[model samples]
Target: MMGGPSENPELWAFLESLHCGEFLSGTVTAIERFGVFVALDDGPDHPVFPGVGFISFAELSWQRFEAASDVVQVGQRVSCEFLQFDTWNLEARLSLRATQPDPFQVFADGAAVGQKLHGRVTKLAPFGAFVQVVDGIEGLVHLRELAWTPVETPSDAVQVGDEVTVVVTEIDRERRRLALSRRKGSSEHR
Candidate 1:
């Protein structure tokens, strides 16, 4: 059974009536260029679901994800927020992004420029390692920012799951971006 319906017909009926807000524990049936397909356990039948749910790409996560396959696989189960449902089309919009706090927001609202944060390496790119400040939120530790010495690639200094301290050098909220350095400071050195 889906998370929305726990065998209580009354609760299900009530939930079905007002189809806005978050929905949790949905099943992922497909991953496509347009979006991820999730069959809502609590979603209403055709003609009523259209206006109630929506999933925007921006609201999908706090991390930098290029492809859905990296985090979500076909038939894999995931928790998502029901943003809107198109009842006319019998379609729903869901977002994994809505399920967590934006990392950029956390850095912007609290961590001052140059404040140090401990993060775990989640992914390594040619330029840097993606570090998680918290679940679903990540900032990039660029290769140039890994240490005082030159690093050809990010993997030299840290491997996935390695925990390291990083300083917040810059934040671009509009872009949903963060720049971090591993070097220690009063200077917040790179």
Candidate 2:
């Protein structure tokens, strides 16, 4: 199988010139369960594709959506941040979400420790439950913080979808993480 250098020399040069985080404008060529394809306004003809830019489902948006079409449509114009050169697929790995505002950053900017907020438990893990404190922003409610009493499992404290009151115990903005506590009170109550 051909593996080393790109068979399409022109495409290789174009890809190399593009750097990560560079903005590219394109028309949405196709949308599927996996990703959305874009026909870049720049670049040489793709011998086999109508488009040469790809945005995986995870890179489509910061907000949860039912499908790729929910964020973009065929023939729709879009601006994406270049992520990497996909040698395997000979496509530009791009992110639509990177070009948009991050809800986590915005929330962290205004949030503080010990503040209380109502959130819904969206997922359960062996260690804790992930709660959506705001749209597109979820934080971990550690097993130890599930309650004041000792808890063996996350389910024992709160099941998924439970509306619970939690305290913002920590906010690590550099790591983009929000540590939450499901316990009734802050250290003041202890």
Candidate 3:
């Protein structure tokens, strides 16, 4: 359980045979600030890790959390979609969120262009601001859509944590993108 592949032939074989997109069951073995380690139920001891499976922060859940532990606790059973065999880390890259329904899909189903919504600015970039329209749902307010006047940066119009009202301009369901605008006429209302 603590050594390399030679120490666990069964695990070595199982790890080697795993492919991307395969769904596997595992128990949360350890929780770290960066990610969660899973002891795969169907696999053997990892050569270096406490578990054979690992899920990064982004793959833990669709809903954003302050920490990984907020989403998964040690000893919890989880089914994950195998993203890839992380050769560099010698661990299986897994995504727990993939097995769950996407919140964006649900938001898109009920949202329409020209719908006005109030949301808080979650992040700011030079090009735009990402507004959290709903739990686990964010839409981009492009710099050009930030205001009617020409804007040099997103911060010129909005800052992180600012609650602002915006109109939905475009929703690309396939791409899971929502384009929003603060300026009235800037929105692509259909």
Clashes by residue pair, model 2:
none
What Cα-based lDDT does every candidate model obtain?
0.67, 0.86, 0.87
Query: lDDT per residue, candidate 3, 51-115, as tens digits?
Result: 88999998998887898878989999999999987655668899999999899998988999999
Q: Which digits, one per residue and each the tens of the lDDT, describe model 1 over residues 94-153?
A: 678777776668758976787888889889999998988766668898888787778888
For candidate 2, the per-residue lDDT at 34 reads 78
TM-scores of the candidates are 0.53, 0.83, 0.77
lDDT for residue 155 in candidate 3, whole number 0-100: 84
Which stretches in model 3 have alpha-carbon errors above 4 Å? 1-8, 87-90, 151-163, 173-175, 185-190
Q: Which structure is stronger by lDDT: 1 or 2?
A: 2
Better of 1 and 2 by TM-score: 2
Once superposed on the true structure, which residue ranges of model 1 sit more than 4 Å away at CA? Answer: 1-44, 47-103, 184-190
Kindly give the number of clashing pairs for every candidate. 17, 0, 0
TM match of model 2 to true structure: 0.83
Model 1 error, position 52 (Å): 7.8
Off by over 4 Å in 2: 1-7, 184-190
